[model samples]
Target chain A: MNIMTPTPPSKGRVDVDNFALSYDTLEGPVEAVSNASIHVNPGEFVSIVGPSGCGKSTLLNAVAGFLKPTRGGVTVDGEPIDGPGADRGMVFQQYSLFPWKTVKGNVEFGLKMKHLDKSSRDRAARTLLGLAGLTAFENKYPDSLSGGMKQRVGIVRALATGPKVLLLDEPFGALDAQTRVIMQQILTNMWQRLKISVLFVTHDIDEAIFLSDRVYCMTARPGSIKAEITIPLERPRHQSMMMSSEFLGLRRGLMSLIREESIKAMGGELNDLALDGLSIDLHGQSLADVL
Target chain B: MKVETFALRREQQTATGPEIGAETSHVRTVQSPAGAPPQLAAYLRRWLALNRRGLRAVLIGAISLALFLLAWHLLTENRVVFFIRFTNVPSPSAVYESLTRAMQDSTFFTHVVLSCRRILFGFSLAALIAVPLGLVMGRFRVAHEILFPVMEVLRPIPAIAWVPMAIMLWPTNEQSIIYITFLGSFFPILVNTLHGMSLVDPVLVRAAQCLGAREVSIFREVYFPASLPHIFTGLTVGMGVAWVSLIAAEMISGQFGIGYFTWEAYSLVQYADIALGMICIGVLGLGSSALIRGLGRLVMPWNRT
Candidate 1:
């Protein structure tokens, strides 16, 4: 696969050191993420997997310059991120394409803001749309497209701006199983061709293991890095490779790491009363024993 | 490989065929005859089939209106003296006769044209002022705080109540009437636009920011377009109120316009002409609202589905 436009060499390198964020509410400041440190080298694919409310999205948002860290710093290529710019592209889980614009129009938006010429904008948008297999939907509005198609357009729109890094917040979380698999494949193909660093946030263990070169597991809130696991899987991975023992072993290790944090996240919400029904029956036999 | 997968999906979708809605199935059953060569007839048949439900709704509305007219006719023709007396009320036939006469009279058209002009001036001015003000207030906290209090204090006072003050303020009756109409429509448009602005999804703003949109572009591209549907809602409601205020103001102060015509007919004891004037107002109000809706559809084509 030939690269349409060559990316700048060794540009996308993200570093977050001892990051902490707390938001104010009626009661007081609530801590979301604390003492979280992570980094992605240029042209690397990194995944952050944790239980809900583990601030995986917060970490991603900070990298995209959407939020200001209360403590510590975030930088890309040795320069601190002051605010959001075209250098870091973000794809939201909600398929946040502008409803008023067509797919191609959405893709052209960032380029337009960058003051690209009309012909160049059109060429860039069309090229990205073709790469995403959305040439048929170039003129279709975001509302008319299905979830999978809309997310594909979102990805294409983000990539059209030629960002050094792509930040995705569970971009495939809303898709059905079949569409999600296909989307993963499409995304990997695009990532390979673009040669850009990716910071993907997801709770799915299999998704994390399959897509990332390295996976970082975070503890429950206030979230911090729990473990960093390297994926030794070879490049150009196939769907059939998921059945291999090596893949299964990676999946098992990631799942247990996540399951422990998930249980802890639920600990505050689930009291003894909630677990009593699961423990024993009226006949004095434990429910687990009967099952 | 991706292309092949997409092609396979497309083939599957085509094999399954397009899904038809439950309402459309009945229309499909009443299809045009096979091998029919009359293109005009075939086209008409297809149109009728597509619009069967819409046609049924129109038929139902007409029947309901006929029933109301019959009840009114019966009550007046028999001179029924119940809790509310119909003895002095004009019969449906009398009103219809007067309507026909008024239709032929050039002066009645003059009244309608003058009234429509007032509404056009007042409503357009209201929309032009309110939309921008509302957008600014909705997006900026300082603007909202400064303007919102003033608006809240004045909003409770009806446009009809402003007629006297308008008469004293404006030099001419035409200006005063137009002012009243403006007062009637201004608040609804402003308030609804503000509401729309508040409802804009925060995630969208973040997405735009991530795409390198500055503050000005975000306001122009995201906030403005997102608030449009609510602005249209405001316009429709404001239009109705504008007509009400325009009529009231004209009846109070004007020498021309449909409202003045109706008041004049009542003074002269031409009860039938009074009814005719009211019918004219009804039809014109309905027509103008339909115009606004049509304009809305044109502007927001993506919202049609």
Candidate 2:
């Protein structure tokens, strides 16, 4: 079988134009995303940033073709998204490596599915294990890895098949603050090297600012893109930039937008704003009203 | 700084004074209680209650056995119970002697072999059939739907109910006994197997899916290994059931088995021998169940919880 036969010309590029998603819980169809559109050019790193439960993960899954939008569509290259396939790889927050297989075996999994020869698969697995900074730990099981290390292997396992694009669902959300920063650096280095089209979903605002070439800021429930902030900072950026004035300005503006939306999300509450010690005197109107 | 300083000096003097008044206020005489051994004895009582299942079991078993033996002794020695003749019953020491005499004869080993052979055969058969069927039922909805109802119907029926049916169908004594034992143990194995297989983490399935494991191979490689703990559970339960059913079947009809021997001694009014056989059966049942429990621990080494 030909590996590249009939692959759509724009297969590496993903476009979700006017996409709307809803989930039916015990109550009713909860509208998650509406008229949300984002473009991820091939080999670009983009992050979707929002509050928890703002449908960022649902959107990622929609792109992964695990869920269908109620309206609009997601297309890769020029092909309409249908269902999950080998071409798209997903790394979940929990590092869902099969417990029964070792890290090496987990990385070798996709190649095994392709029925690759043992020697070749072993060689490729070794390379991926090294790329993930888990070379010596390949034979170790996922249960033994730290949260950061586990996510590394999770990312590596997804990349094992050489999927053109990678989908990360809160990929480092479960790690401790210190460990999370380290993982972010490790992932940033790994992504720069791999150059795979990455669409990362995260709730951490700072993480979004740090990793994304362009960050799509989303609102509360019934989510939509409130703003798209482009990082003009140079590539191969370091942690030192995180404390710079330019970084702080972007951070402050993004946080203000988030806080205003959060207040609006609670239905324009008056109590927190009216408490005597803390004054809310920004033009003497609610933040949402001003917006 | 004048009167306030004088008040501060007074407070400091009081604070610096001895704290003995606070210390001795709550004391009481714990020595007043009858048979109380003081502080160390109280600690010993607390320790025993807080931990020690063996102590609990021993206390309960001792009380139960005392009541049982007292009743037995009364019924036979005082001739209180009308159903059994005084001659048909024996004192506890007489029964003990009969147990020793039976041990000396050494014919009991044959009976033990007969029962164990039947149980092992049936239990193994049940495991063979139930484990695979259960794996299928757990993995495939169609298989579960087709077989689940049939098993539910058969599960409630007692093993003794199948005896007449087994007699007619198998046409051999040992085959019929094995059949009854197999039927008795089969349902627990099947149900536990299905429970174990289905209880596998769905996240594991998804992980395997995203990792590119194909359908049949996925079940073989992932689902099967994950279900091992449950499979072992079924086997252990089946082992116990097989023992229970085999003995019950032997008691109902057998020329030579521990169960049959008990029944024969009962008819001949060898009361001591009958008591001795009952004790043997009880001990064997306990010993076998312990063995299965040991096997369970070996299989699930990660089950610290």
Q: Write the per-residue lDDT of candidate 1 for residues B161-184, one digit (tens) a residue.
A: 998899899999899999999999
What CAPRI class is candidate 1?
high
| Predicted candidate 2 versus true structure: per-residue lDDT over A1-291, tens digit per residue | 322232333457889999898878999888988779998988878999877667888899888877899999898776898777667888998887776678898888878887888888888888778767788898776777788888888888888787777899998889999999888888888778767788999878888888888889888888899999998777787888899998889889889878766655666454564535466556777889977
Which portions of model 2 show Cα errors greater than 4 Å?
A: A1-11, A23-30, A264-291, B1-110, B261-305
* Clash list (residue pairs), candidate 2: A10-A77
lDDT of 2 at B148: 92
Q: Candidate 2, overall lDDT?
A: 0.80
Per model, kept true contacts as a fraction are 0.82, 0.42
Screening candidate 1 with a backbone cut-off below 3 angstroms (N, C-alpha, C), the clashing residue pairs are none
Q: What is the DockQ of each candidate?
A: 0.83, 0.25
Candidate 2 per-residue lDDT, tens place, B1-305, comes to 34445665665565556652344557632222223223666667777887789888999999999999887887777766566577557777788888777777868778878877887788889989998999999999999999899888889998888888888899788999999989988988898889888788876676666656678877876787788777877777777777777777888867778888888888888878788778788887788778777876775453424
Evaluated with TM-score, which candidate comes out highest?
A: 1
Look at candidate 2 and tell me the lDDT of residue A40. 91
lDDT agreement with native, every candidate: 0.91, 0.80
